[model samples]
Target chain A: MNRVNGDAVLGAAIVVASVLAVLVWVPRDTGSAIVEVVRGSMRIGDALAPTIGFSLLGIAGLILMIEARATGSTLRLDRFDLVFIAGVGGIFLCAMLLMRWSGPLAAALFSDESYRNLRGTLPWKYVGFIIGGGFMIGTLISLVDRRLTARVYLLGFVVALCLALVYDLPFGSLLLPPNGDV
Target chain B: MDYVLLGIQSVFSNTAMFSVFGVGIPSCLVTLFLGLLTGIAVGATPGLAGPTAMAVSLPILISVFGVRPDALLPVFGFLIGVMKGATVGGAVPAILFNVPGTPDAIMTTLDGHPMAKRGMPRRALRIAHFSSVTGDTASDIVLFVCAPFLAIMVERFLDLPEKTALIILSLTFISSVMGSSVGKGLIAVALGVLAATVATGQTFHPRLTLGIDGLQNGFPMVSAVLGALILGEIFVTLNDIWRGERQASTVQSSHGDVADGLQKGDLRRIMPHIARSSVIGTLIGALPGVGSTLAATLGYTVGRGIHKRRKRPEDPDFGEGAPEGIAATEAANSAVSGANLIPVLSLGIPGNAAAVFLILAADSIGGFNPGPAVFNFTRPQINPELVVAFGIFTLMALGNLLNWTIGGAFMRAMSVMSRIPIRLLLPIVLMVTLTAIYIQDTRMAALWITFGFGILGFFFRRLDIPVLPFVIAFILAGTLENTARQAFSATGGDPFFLFRSATSVIFLLMAVAIIVFLGRRKGHGAAATHPN
Candidate 1:
């Protein structure tokens, strides 16, 4: 109950703060702040009004939501199961981000030229495979079934090989850009 | 004394900041274009960042037009103008192609892509592009106030370790706020730091050059950035294309209605997060190397946390197409472009990747080094330069404001891309990947790096790693490490010198405290299930 009340109070406070800032503080510096004169700045004295006006307009929306909450609307949330996912996301996200900066990791793993070439290659086919394979493997054996895991492993390897052969299969044939196109 | 006044005049004497007023004119053009076309073509091509459009064209002004120093103002003014154009243009492809034009386009993908698939690509593209530009322009003004105001304080901050520690705190913040786990964020950072160590030897000799002459001077910044970040994105696209079975292009229908367009109700709901995102972007962007990505995440996270502490009845949509998501992302990403300069002007540190490139250019001209001395000596002394900065900032603000009101409409035109089969899209991404990297130097080695990072990135994404902190750490590690080394030499290699400053002490404590707090959350099962 206290938590609920606290949440409500905070919501009210946000709304109140928005209101106060818009009503009192905004007008005092209306002329001085940067946002003024954005709209119709084709002329002088026309800029500041729109900037502050829109800001307050935005604030008004928040206030309405707060008042409506006396009925029963709250920001949607997934239980703890989902919110915490953001944490794990941070990990994998960071890993990929760091990998770009990791010249050592790249050099250790692959040739520099080939590595540079790979960035542009993500196609729908790959997305299809991941999504399709996930669905197929997921459906065929619940993904965790012992037999399914081996099949998925085999399937992935085979697909990877085919991809290497098909798209990355090199051709010495060269043609210059046609002058008309160029 | 007269010099200062003259410099100030150069900046503002253009008919009472009218030059600044002229800058916003581009935004009006961009926003209007967004409205008219409802989309832009070719911006979604991989490796083209919002700033790249300007970077590539910068030389044309010099070589073709024979621009003098006086012409630099109008030239950069045009580039800044182009940046505003690109920010809105970037959204078109992001909505249509799922591939983003800039990192800021990443947010547009969440709902915009979905809307495109539903055949309302036009509406989604227009609305999102509109919302994005609006939010972007709004934040630019926020930075106009916030960065200079913060500079007054950041300029006074004298502790090296504290600055380092603050960066650590920011890294920690990135990890915690990522959709994955802190462990992953940390692992990524470690990996990034390790990556930065390559080819950097003690002094006379470059390490890990490994017999490559080009590498002896270290990876060229363009190649490295292009290779790791850009190519990596492309390779992943190719990998996806290869793995998939969907070979046909998708045919999407158009969904349009005035009521379906963003209603006042939509804008009303998104305001708070918009405000919050603007503030966070302004604050973080003022620091160097912590660019739009961190600002983006910070804004995104504030929205995420808002869900946890929901006050507004409309909070549930926070992550989805909720205006807050769009608002936060647009505001934060755009604002950071301005904020990232604070460090460049106040300190010599380049705040983000684009700034680093600019710094290299500025340095070649015997410009004052980017530190306190620059402010005192280099700043007020240059009459025209001050004019340039002021014109740039004020004009950029105008450009952004104009972007907000109408630029998104231009992006909506890209809905035609949905007509392409998904299969073709995937393979095209691959082909484009090959062509782009090859153009960097016809080096095949970059391809393999792209492939490797793609797989690595895939694995990291699969495992839920926070990519941003790792990227940031990678960018900053060399500088941070070098700074620490210099400070050490300044104190005769005493390791304790890092700890000697009271400012350092305070930053260290703050870093420790933040890590402990965030770390404890890790210790609990709070993040166990997600385990990125």
Candidate 2:
């Protein structure tokens, strides 16, 4: 991690801001705020759960930055890593700002058919476009001096894809519920 | 108890049991056959790993057995065989080409390559065969018997916090296992956790998947794993090729008696080391997420530690082509395979990256995923599943024995086996890979996801990124979410109600302490690296 001072400063900003926002905006009632899968709900077991998880994640990011500073190392912050974190942050911020209504938006980000729920949100689509655009640029930069046999790459990709698709097509239907009820 | 009676009854449940005898047994034979062919190929090539054989096989297992509950035993059985066989097969390449088939086989290359260079390739193969079989068979028994019992104990103690701790332990174990830097280990787990996170459903919200509905099901682990591990390595190979790395010089074999040439005492000579490796392997395997590195490292260190440095012949010594090297490695490598299953089978948590995905596949196919309850409670009485497992275990033991004893005998003719090079081998590998993945879960998206993951895996390796954290995160996501949700409803939205559960609070505190510790300076004045 080179340029540890910069990374620490930047990482500290990201983590601290995110953690603070998460802690502040989150419902005080850990029980109701936290979502579950197996059990329907609970009465405040780990109110600090997400904050803690995220906080830990933040701490990790921060520590990484500090270490990078100490080592005089720098993480080549690419469009991909930074943008992905930012996008996640944006989703978190939206969830915090919009309250429960944000659930659908959150779902949209999570689900493949997010656009259906958020049909009129063309601006958000731009967000998606920007993110995609950034990643493609990253890919371009990541591509080095090597003539990858387009045939081998293509063949590998195609074969892998076809196999993946073939497997799913027969049972992709299983992805949905048995009788169509949610 | 019905468990014992059920076990007896299962033997007669010919429909399923026969699959083991028929499909499972034959698959074991195929494992031997494939093991030989692969051993030759990997032996002939440099840098390819033996476990990639299992990687290729896993997706196939998922596909072919995806819809059927009964098929798991055979599929997994076949997998076990492939794993054991590949270890043996790796020696083929190690012996003839002076190129190891697996990372573990590098030690074999030291001596075997020298022997081959000196036109004693047959001798090197015989020594490898002699020792690998002895060590592997010894290790498998420990895996078979102890795995079930440990699993039983784990079921009782496994809880969310403890599960988290176990994962942490696995991380540490991984760190210590590879004399590789802790940063690398941490990076591996981080990436693994990140990978697991990619296919989030129960977590707060998914990251990485930009509104792809397919992602809600979570990252199709099989393909992703294949892509990351297998395909990613392939890219590295391409990189090496572009860099003009020297490949093994291919040559045809001149036949010789495979094992007859080796002195009888060589088998007896390596036994103590083999036994020692089995113990080390089993101990490492019992823990979750601790993979082969632990077993191999322990085996290697101990073998070196206890070895009486015999005065060497000018021909080349232990580091070059010693039999004990094979003993220690085979013991550690094969033992790790069997033992790695301990945590997964006993506790529902996967201890290693491979086991993590294996658990998902097992859970999806076992008609239910494995968990703590699966261990202690009376299982879904399937006319004696334990009996079936016992049979499979018995077969695994037998299969391993067969591979070691006969497989070693066969490998003496390393000249016959090590001719296939990477150029011809890569395509066949892809073909097998496609067939296997197609059989497992049969999802094209999974396949595509695999390729994408392959790239991710490659970059992660190159960049020294950790995937283990990602995997652990994914595993914990649902639990964390559900625990939070349950805590919420129990208190009727009173966030303070979380204080009621004294147990949960203690666990949460421990987690905090861990975070603090992780943030603390690791050792000396160096920047604090995460433990795992």
Candidate with top lDDT is 2
Span of 10 residues, lowest total lDDT, candidate 2 chain B = B523-532
lDDT of 2 at B439: 47
For every candidate, C-alpha RMSD to the true structure in Å: 18.8, 10.5
What is the TM-score of each predicted model, taking all chains together? 0.55, 0.68
Candidate 2 residue A167 C-alpha distance from true site, Å: 11
Docking class of 1: incorrect
Off by over 4 Å in 2: A1-32, A35-53, A66-182, B1-47, B59-66, B157-216, B245-260, B308-317, B353-357, B377-388, B409-419, B423-448, B472-532
Q: What is the lDDT for B365 in model 2?
A: 65
Compose the digit string of candidate 2's lDDT tens values, residues B152-202.
665565544444444445444443233223333444444454445443433
Q: Lowest-lDDT window of 10 residues in candidate 1 chain B?
A: B30-39
Candidate 2: chain B TM-score against the reference chain B: 0.76
- Worst ten in a row by lDDT for model 2 chain A: A173-182
- What does candidate 1's lDDT look like per residue over B441-490, in tens digits? 34444434544454445444433454445555555556666565445445
- What DockQ does each candidate score versus the true complex, computed on alpha carbons? 0.02, 0.08
Each candidate's interface RMSD, rounded to one decimal? 20.8, 10.0
Give Cα distance to truth, residue A80, candidate 2, Å.
Answer: 17
